[model samples]
Target: MLDQTIKVELSTTKKQKPNADQLQFGKIFTDHMFIMDYTEGKGWHDPRIVPYQPITLDPSSVVFHYGQTVFEGLKAYVTKEGKVQLFRPEKNMERLNQSNDRMVIPKIDEQFALKALKQLVSIDKDWIPTAEGTSLYIRPFIIATQPFLGVAPSSQYKFMIIMSPVGAYYKEGLNPVKILVENEYVRTVKGGTGTAKTGGNYAASLKAQEISSQKGYSQVLWLDGIEHKYVEEVGSMNIFFKIDGKVVTPELSGSILPGITRDSIIQLLKYWNIPVEERKISIEEIYEAYDKGLLEEAFGTGTAAVISPVGELLWKDRKIVLNNGETGPLSKKLYDTLTGIQYGTVEDPFGWIVTVE
Candidate 1:
C-alpha cells in the first residue's frame, strides 16, 4: 500500500506572478511542486511537496536512453466566487496509470495521486488564473530514474506534479484553425506507444508538424499508420466532424490516445440529444461528405484547447473549408458549456468538478 500522508514544505521566497492577461501556456510555474519516488522493492515512498527547483538525475538515466515515461495534463480553474476546483482530474490519474501500464512502469495508486494533486493545487491555489479562458495547467508525469545502460525498464522512478498558469492554448482562442493532412510521416501504428502519453510518440510527430507549419497550418491531421486512409486524430487533440447533421469521431483503434476531454464532449453531446458516432472514418469519406455539402463543422478536443474548431483541412492537393471558416454553433455550445461548468458558471450535472478547499 502507498503512504497516505504527504509532507508539505512552503517556499521561502515567492516568485512574481504574471498578469493574467499576459500568461502563456506552460511558461510560468508555481512556487512548489509534488513529488514521489518509486523503487522495485520499496515501492512508492516519501510523498512530499517541495520548492520548485531543478532535479539532478544521472547522465545515464533510463528515461534519457530508452524514453520510458508517461504523463497526463489537466487544469485547475478559479471560479467567480474565488474557489479553486479541478475538472475531471481523477480521469487524468486513471489515464496516467493506463500509460504506465503500457510503458512497463509500476502502477501508481490513483486515489492517492489525486489526493496529492489536490493538496498541491490547494497550496498554490492563487496560481489559478481568473481571466476568461485562463486556468492553471497541471502536468503529472513519471520518469525512469535508475542509472543503467540496459535497454529495459528502470528499477527506480519518479512521479512528479507541476503546474503553470496558462492562457488560451491557441492564439486564436476559440476561433477555427487550419489543419494539414499528413500523408508521409505517420504518428504511430497499432501495437505501439501511440495510445500511451509517452514522449516518443510526440517526438515522432515533430517532423510532420514542422512541415505543416511552413504550409500555414496550425496542426496536422494524422491518419492510421497501416492503411494511411482512416482519420485518427489531430496533433495535440482528438478530432470530431459534423456530417449530415450527425457527429462522428474515429474509434479508439489502439493507435490513438483516449482523451478525457474527447470522451466528455461525446457524453455531453449525447446528453443534449445530439447524434454522435465513433468509428473508422476515412479522409476520402470526409471529402465525399464535403462534395455533397454535408460536412458542416470540424473540431478537436483535448485538455489544452478544450475545443478547437477546424476552419480548413488540406488533404493532398484538395482542400475544404468548414462552416464558412468560422466556429460552428455546436462547437461554440460545447465550448461554452464545458468552460461554464469548469469555471462554476454552469451547473455540472456530470459531477466532473472536484473542489479543492
Candidate 2:
C-alpha cells in the first residue's frame, strides 16, 4: 500500500480561470496538480499536491528516447445539487496499473491513487465547470524519468494528475462525424501495446490521423494490424455499430482498448434488456450490413467524447452514410443516459459514482 499521508502545498499565486463559455479541451489547466515519484529500490514515495508547474528533466530521459509511459483520462462533474462526483474512477486506476505492467513500470495502489485523486479534486473543486456539457477533465499519467539512453526500463518514474476545465471534445457536439478508414497504416496488432493506453500507440496513429484530417474527416477508423481487414477501433475512441435492432461493438481481441465508457454502455444496454454483442466485427461485414439496411446507427465511446455518433464512413472508394447522416435515436439515448449518470442527474443503478465529499 502507498503511504496514506499526502503532503499538500497550496499554490502561492493563481491564474485567472477561463470563462465557461470559452473553455476548450485541454487548453487550460487548474491551479494545482498531484505528483509522486518512484525509485528503483525504494518504490513510490513523496506523494504531494502542489502548484501546477513544469519540472526540468534531463535531455536523455528514458521517456524522450524509448517512450515508456502510460496515461488515463476521467472527469469530475458538478451535480445539480452541487455535489462533485466521478464515474467509475477505480476502473481507470485499474487500467492504469494494467498499462504500467505492460510498460514494465511499477504498480501503484489503486485505492490510494483514488484517495489522492479525490483530495486533489476536492481542493480544486471550484474548477469543475457547471456549464452544459462541461466538466473538469482529469489526466493521470506516468513517465520514465531516468536520465538514460538505454532501451530497458528506467530506474525512475513520475506519476502525475492534472485537471483541465473543458467543453465538448468535438466541435460537432452530439452531431454525427465523418470517419475515414485507413488501409495504409495500422495502429497496433494483437499481443502489442494497442490494448494498453500508452503514448506509442497514439503516436503511431498520428500519420493516419493527419492524412484523414487533410481529407476532411473527423477521425480515422483503424483496421486490424495483421490482415488489415477486421475492424479495430477509432483513433481516440472505441467504435460500435447498431445493426438492425441489436448493438454490437468490436471484441477486445488483445489489440483493442477496453474502454470504461464502452463497458458502461454494454452493461447499460443489458440492464435495459437491449441486445448487445462483442465479437470480431469486420469492415466488410459492416459495409455488407449497411447494404442490407441493417446498419442503423454507428458511434464511438471514450472519455473525451463520451459518445460520438458516426454519420458517414469512407473506405477505399466506397462511402456509406448512416441514419441519414444525423444522430440516431439510440446514440442520443446512450449519450443522455451516460452523461446523466455522470453529471448526477440520473439514478446510477450500477453504483459507478464516487463522490468527492
Measure candidate 2: CA RMSD.
1.0
lDDT, candidate 1, 108-209, per-residue tens: 999999999999999998888787888999999999999999998899999999999998665555789999999999999999988999999999999999
Best by lDDT: 2
lDDT of 2 by residue, 257-340 (tens): 999999999999999999999998999999999999999999999998899999999999999999999999999999999999
Cα displacement (Å) at residue 217, model 2: 0.6
Q: Which stretches of candidate 2 lie over 4 Å from their true place?
A: 170-173
lDDT of 2: 0.94
Q: How high is the CA lDDT of each candidate model?
A: 0.93, 0.94
Q: What is the C-alpha RMSD of each candidate to the true structure, in Å?
A: 1.0, 1.0
Give the true-structure RMSD of model 1. Answer: 1.0
